[model samples]
Target chain A: MDILESIKVALEGIWVNKLRSALTMLGIIIGVAAVIAVVTIGQGGRAAILSSLESMGTNLFVVYPSSRNATTPITRQDLITLEDVEAIKNIVPTVKAVAPTSYLSIMTQVGRQKEKTTIICTGQDYKSIRNLELVEGRYFTSEENNSRRRVAVINEELAKTYFSGESALGKQVYLMNTPFIVIGVVKNDPSNALGFGGDPPKEATIPFHTGETLFRNLRIQIEGQTYSKEEVQETIDQIVKLLHKRHRNEGKYRGYSLDQEVATANKILGIIALIIGSIAGISLLVGGIGVMNIMLVSVTERTREIGIRMALGARRRDILVQFLIEAVVICLVGGTIGTILGTGGALAVALIAKWPPLITPGTIFIAFFFSASIGIFFGIYPANKAAKLDPIEALRYE
Target chain B: MIKISNLTKVYRTGAISVTALKGINLEVAKGSMVAIMGPSGSGKSTMMNILGCLDRATSGSYIIDGVDVSTLQEKELAKIRNHKIGFVFQTFNLLPRLTALKNVELPMIYAGIPSKERRERALKALDKVGLADRIHHRPNELSGGQRQRVAIARALVNNPAIILADEPTGNLDTRSGEEIMDIFQQLNQEEGVTIIIVTHEREIADHTRRIVHFRDGVIIKDEEVLTPISARTTLAALPPAGEV
Candidate 1:
């Protein structure tokens, strides 16, 4: 029979028993919907994580002091110096900028507003080393850093807390009861990349020398160690060698690179994304099985129809094509509906919950192609069954 | 023309073998109306099925219009059924979902006729059966006589070499059955289409010009009926072989 007529007949068969056909399609619908929803969510999560990492500045490297003994804590002596930062830049061609940051937990009072936030002390190059957007005023100059002038750049949250609708730049804020002038107000960093999760921590930055003098007392049992800016490379080399020599008593500190740790963080995020995507892929498999099950039932129900077509001059290939077309139609319909629903769900979540839910064209293509292949893969047995039916016996069937 | 010699059909049901047609020998001339009359289990339906190329004989030499049909493959046999024979079952076998017109057009669709031409031919066949106005009526909407008439139109739509009816009137009333027989007689006389009816009723057999009696898978009698003058004139006016 002509393909159009066969399609008409198949459609009529489906329409004749609307409830059964709809119930059968439900399996496909659920399967497609599950696949779309899971994939969309997974993709959104991956984007969120990558974006969060990106906000930390792609060019910056984080260094942490390692110890062989878990109980041994890294102290102020283990802190990276400006000289070490310059040495890394000079020695490593790929190192564009280096900012050694030290954090102190302190109570800061802006007028009557008081909040506890992390105050990071770093060099004049810290602003350039990180992709920190300044919303007001300007970063502290190198001259101010050399003079050990007390100046700070407050984060958006801290600025709002201290200034309360007023611009915080050029205003005095007290850190640990020590007065400091705010030179700049940094823009709010994205809570997380891709907008999948909660907001990140609040922080502020100040000139390195100012931070050390205000937060540290010279009366402590430690010798004052000062290195010139030009000797930063030698200072970093000496620090590495000294640490290695001192830790020669232990094996854990060997072969450790701060840059390697940052790179490993990115790698971990990538692996997490892959694992999430793979977990979502399990739904596609279930959808394929659903197609197979429904197709098997359809073939059994249409046995006599297959027999009649064969007896009426249809070839085995014709029967195969007919049944395969029906299977594909079911999946294509389900896939299209699922794609729409998935995209809508993503958009809704993004809009209503203020979460970033990305729906990329690539994701749609993947979902569609995967669903179509599922149809073909599951349709084979049913098509073969229809094609291989004995015409005489089928005709004799009640 | 058709020829069958030493036809045997043995069906295996598990370990036991049942002979449906045993050494049957029969010949049917072109343009002749014939009936195969017998009681149930006399193998008349089996012979009809074999004649229509819907089944294969275990052993036989059966030729139709110079082609040996008994040795053809399943696909080739389907081709024969599509182009050389049309079947009318007692059940009507009208797909319940399709209209009368579509039912008649089905065979031509398998023959790969284009839609426009298939519709035209199907309408003409329905017109011949006097159900042209009911083309869009589904089988359930149609009366028993109208449904059987639609089947007749379907059987005639392909213009095959032979029309094979297996108890065509078995489901119809006496009046509807007579009406169907009249249409068959008209097709045989005016269209010069060869007709074969498998029936157990003598009244149904009496309408045909020839009868082939089967008993227990064998032909017991073959006899010719005397045709009326008008029927002879109608047959004479029909187009010759290959013209219709």
Candidate 2:
């Protein structure tokens, strides 16, 4: 029989039992929709995390001091020094910029408002090194750091809290009861690298020289040895060499790179996304099984019809094509509707939750083709059964 | 022409076998009207199935028009069914979802006739069966007699070498049954189309020029009717068209 005629017959069969056909297609629809939505949501999440990590400076490295002694603390000098930063930049050609930093939490007063916030003290080029942005004012100049001027930069949150209804630039804020002029209001950084929780830090910044002069005496112990200003580089070198030289400490420092950390986090997120997507794909498998079940029922119901066609000279291939087309039509229709619903669902969630949900063309193609294949795969047994039916037996069927 | 010798059909149901046809021998001339009469389970229906290429015999040497049907493949058998034989069932078997015209056009579609020609030939067939005005009427809308007439038109549409009917009037009342038999007789006598019908009624058998009696899957009697009644006269004796 002609293919068009077979299609017509299949369509007529579907039309004759509209409710059954629709119910059969529902499984495929939900399956495709779930697959599409889950994959899109996963993709959106990956993009969100990657962006957050990237905003922390893709090439920046952070090192924390470690000590075996319970009484020892990782002082700013013990962890890093100006000389080590210079040496790393010069000796390691790949190292771009390094700025040592120290922070302390102190209560500060601005006008009548008082808040406790962490204040960071770093070198002149700290802003450039950490990729900080200034929204309202400018960073402190090198001359200000050399002169030990009491100048500070406030983060956007701190600026909003202390300088509400007024510009924070050139304003005076009290840090540990010491008056300091705000040279700049820093832009809110996208990454929350230093925050204890997932939130960005609320803080202030000051020149490292000014911090050193105000704080007076400082000491850092490394491996039972006391390290002062001149010995800071020696302490850092001993720590690095000791950690790398000992076989017992090899695991602690093995492949310990910032890029590796970022890559590991990305890999973890990728695995989570895949797991969620596969769980959703189970619905598609169930839908395909539903198609197969409904097709079997349809063949049983249409036995007499099959017999009539066979009696009218329909070949086995014709019977096969007719039933197979019916199944494919159901799945194709379901896939199309599922894609639309899935995209709409993703968009609605993104809008409500305010998270970026990406729906790519590749996802659409995968969903469509996957559902079509499901139809064909599930349709085989029923089609074969119909094709193999004996015309005499079918005709005599009640 | 048709020939069958030592044709046997055994149907297996699990471990048991039922012989539907046993060593049947028969011959039919090119353009003759013949009817086979038998009781239920006498295997006349099985003989009809084998003759129409709807079933295969377990052992046989059956030839139609020159081709050995027993040696034909399933596809070749389907071709024979498509272009060499037309079937009229007692229940009409008109597709309920299709119109009378489409029901008649079904065979032509299987024959790969294009839509234009299929439509033309279907309409002409319906016209021959005196259902031109009811071409678009679905089976449920037509009376039993009209439905059976539509089946006749479908049988004629493919211009097959032989027309096979299995108890064509078994489901109809006497009047409608007589009307159907008259149409069959007209096709055989006027168009010179070879016809073979299986029926249990002697009156129906009398309408044809020859009768073959089947008993226990075997032919017991074969006789010729010297005085062949004119079917057109009987058809004319009925009420005019559209009066049922």
Interface RMSD of each: 2.3, 1.1
| Clash list (residue pairs), candidate 1 | A48-A193, A48-A194, A51-A193, A52-A193, A83-A232, A87-A233
Task: Report the lDDT tens digits of candidate 1 across residue range A1-398.
Answer: 67887676566666776776576566666666666766666566555555665565433334445554435555555444555555555654444555656777778886677878788787766776556789999998878887889888888878876677998878998888878898898876653343334554467788777777777731111011112223333434444554445444322222323233345655776776677556556665776677678778878877776766665567777778777777776677778887887777767766675557888788889778877787788888888988888876776667
In terms of lDDT, the best-performing candidate is 2
| Candidate 1, position A331, lDDT | 74
> Which tens-of-lDDT digit does each residue in B35-95 have in candidate 1?
8999889998788878988788999889998899988987788889888888788878787
Which stretches of candidate 2 lie above 4 Å from their native place?
Answer: A48-57, A66-78, A81-83, A86-95, A102-121, A140-152, A157-183, A192-262, A344-360, B228-232, B235-244
Binned by DockQ into CAPRI classes (incorrect, acceptable, medium, high), candidate 2 is medium
TM-score of each: 0.81, 0.84
Ten contiguous residues minimizing lDDT sum, candidate 1 chain A = A218-227
Name model 1 segments beyond 4 Å from true. A1-57, A67-97, A104-116, A137-151, A161-166, A169-183, A190-196, A213-280, A343-366, B223-244
TM-score, chain B only, every model?
A: 0.91, 0.94
Weakest ten-residue segment in model 2 chain A by summed lDDT: A218-227
Against the true structure, whose DockQ is highest? 2
